[model samples]
Target: MPSDIHHPAAAFNRTSFEACVVPYLDAAYNLARWLARDDTDAQDVVQESMLRAFRYFHSFHGDDARVWLLAIVRNTFYSLRSKAAADAKHETFDDEAHTLIDEAPSPEARALISVDIQALQAALENLPHPLREVIVLRELEECSYKEIANITGQKIGTVMSRLARARERLKAELSSSSTEARRHDVR
Candidate 1:
């Protein structure tokens, strides 16, 4: 019986890649979904990112797989966005129609869910891409400043500044929303 040593390299590659990258799948998909703003687009972006990561896995020498994977995801998203931009024609955005509204869930449904995830999602979505990306990386992904800086290819100072601005914007938006809701309730 001849032992198959030829398949060892393939097994090693698959195992190592899985160990390094599998844990960050959710984070990658979340970041992709946020950036792409559509489940289908996000899935596509994540798939592309994974393919690119596997192809260039040899270049990955870092300790933090999440940051590295996120960096790839971010780069892939921007590349897709850039390509879309190049192909884009005139398209007018209707702000009024697209504005996020806080709709009250029915009494039965409200009893089961307490937190309003949609409002936060909408607030984050309304932020500019850079600001939103920083917030998402820091808050949602729970990445450290240095990790975010590395992933974003920005200085730590820039990441901190963007995070600060993102927080302020989110606060203001949420506060204003609450105030409007209160006014509506009093009417």
Candidate 2:
């Protein structure tokens, strides 16, 4: 067998894969982070998604690479989530062994984050997964409705409806949070 470096087809595939997929690694990680809601889990999801993309690179036509990659990322996250849920069912919960701890940030660390930013992040986190993912894709990643529909495997109409609902929910959450904050300030 010839070495891959000397093989023209192999070299071309590798180059094309790098050119199409490597530039979107950060975007992939951001989507995963928002979906998984945990830094370590998001990193793991991105790693698995990249491996899947590389394995299936040959099947990829000359379409939108970002949408393709994000779809894979979204699928991988849901797969892992489902598997984790199944695994949790078999585990025994021990109250003593799983004691919760309060991990509040230091005052300096808290001060570094803007109040409005924190409230927004908290509200986003509180949204259901479906709404949250759509909001993150459209608002944060700047994906169009068609791209989001492709990434989410939803119809364009569904994507639009979800986005509208997510926006309204976010507005209500932000308004309530600001009101509470103002009350605290006045006290």
Clashes of each: 0, 0
Misplaced by over 4 Å in model 1 are: 1-6, 86-116, 184-187
lDDT of 1 by residue, 86-180 (tens): 65522233334334444586654442232234456668878988998999998889999999999999999999999999999999988877665
TM-score of structure candidate 1: 0.80
Worst 10 residues of 2 by lDDT: 89-98
- Give me the displacement of residue 80 in model 1, in angstroms: 1.5
Model 2 lDDT per residue over 43-153, tens place: 899999999998899889979999999999999999999989664422222223223333486644343334556677778878889999999999989999999999999
What's the TM-score of every candidate structure?
Answer: 0.80, 0.80
Q: Which stretches of candidate 2 lie over 4 Å from their true place?
A: 1-6, 86-113, 183-187
The global C-alpha lDDT for each of the candidates, from Candidate 1 onward, is 0.80, 0.84
Total clashes for model 2: 0
Judge candidate 2 at residue 182 and give its lDDT: 65
Model 2's C-alpha root-mean-square deviation from the true structure amounts to: 6.6
